[model samples]
Target: MTRKSTGIPGLDSMLQNGFAFPSAILVAGEPGTGKTTLAVQSLFHGAREGEKGLYITAISEPQWLVQKFLSSFSFYDQQLVEKGMVNFIDLGPSIAKNPSDMLEIIKKKIEQYQPERIAIDPITPMTDLLQWRGETREFMHELFAFLKAFNSLVIITAEMSYDDIAHSQESYMVDGVIVLSYPEEEKVRRKFLEVLKMRGTKHTTGRQLIDITDEGLAVQAGLR
Candidate 1:
């Protein structure tokens, strides 16, 4: 299996080098947990490697606004976007009334650009839009199957409120799962990253401290 670096330092080492190519990973976290930063950094990392990258966002935030926010990070490279190596697609309004439309849009984009890495920032809105467990499950099944066929490394971010991480179905469907969290420790709120699962790869089993800086998200060796 080919390994694709996650672009976050110290994290690749935890996955024994990096994530396997054609793998689907779930990055679940609560608000302010750096989920968006992690996804953008991963996409930028692939762009820097000369591999095409696609970012599909479900929120109403304009593409330019999202780019502007991420530009503060050192990993955010405008050159890659200008060169068409990194492409951003806003699917907020289109999928607001019909979540299944995401599948078609995703398929078309994947077929068109054939990106090596793809990130769906915060898939929670899609799930909420569907509002049916069966529909959400079916959509995920189809989406994951389609992604597997494309031989692309994909990251799907999902918003998790307090105590919701253990019950998220998205965690069960993906090949790998990484959870970013902020838990109270010694009267202080501390950030951490935990690898719940990584199919076909040996990875660290415990939580590690995560740091979000202007450069992006980085994992420390010790858990907070």
Candidate 2:
């Protein structure tokens, strides 16, 4: 199976060189856990590798504000966006107005772009729209099916922690689960990544040190 590189430093090595192709990875983490950084950095990395990339944001913050913040990251390149290698689109407003349309909008966009790499940042908001558990399950099933059919390596970020992973239906729907957390050691706060599960790949398990620098998310070795 082909693997898709995350571009985050030291990450692909642990992921057995990269994520298996056409896989859906759930990036679950709390606020400021570098979820967004991982998503965008992966998209940018794929863009640099000549892959058409798309980032769909369901964040409340405006698209320009997100871009402004992303501009500070060294991995972000305006040239990639300008060249149409990496495209960013905001689905927040539409989803807020018509929550039911979220799935359709995403499906349509994916069909239109046919991007090799796609990121749906913070999928929790989209999940909020569904009032019924059955509806949510169906949505996930259809969404994943659509993505897999397209042969796209998709990353779906969610505002969730390790405690929430077991209960989240999404954790079961996706091919892999990666949790990012900030563990407090004495007076120091440290960021770590844990590969809880990955299908069809031998991945490093346990929490490994990670850093969010100007260069973007970098996964480091050592997890005790």
Which one wins on TM-score?
Answer: 2
TM-score of each: 0.94, 0.95
TM-score of candidate 2 on Cα atoms, chains taken together: 0.95
Per-residue CA lDDT of model 2 for 23-114, tens digit only, reads 99999999999999999999999999999999998877877899999999999999999999999998878888877788899999988888
Across 1-224, the per-residue lDDT of candidate 1 in tens digits comes to: 88989999889989989999989999998888999999989999999888899998889888788889999899988889989899998888888766768788878978998899999998998878776645887788888889988889999999986468667778778999999889998999989888989999999877798888887899975442
Q: When superposed on Cα atoms, how far off is each prediction in RMSD?
A: 1.8, 1.5
Minimal lDDT window, size 10, model 2:
128-137
**Residue pairs of candidate 1 with colliding backbone atoms:** none
lDDT of 1: 0.87
Error of 1 at 107 (Å): 1.2
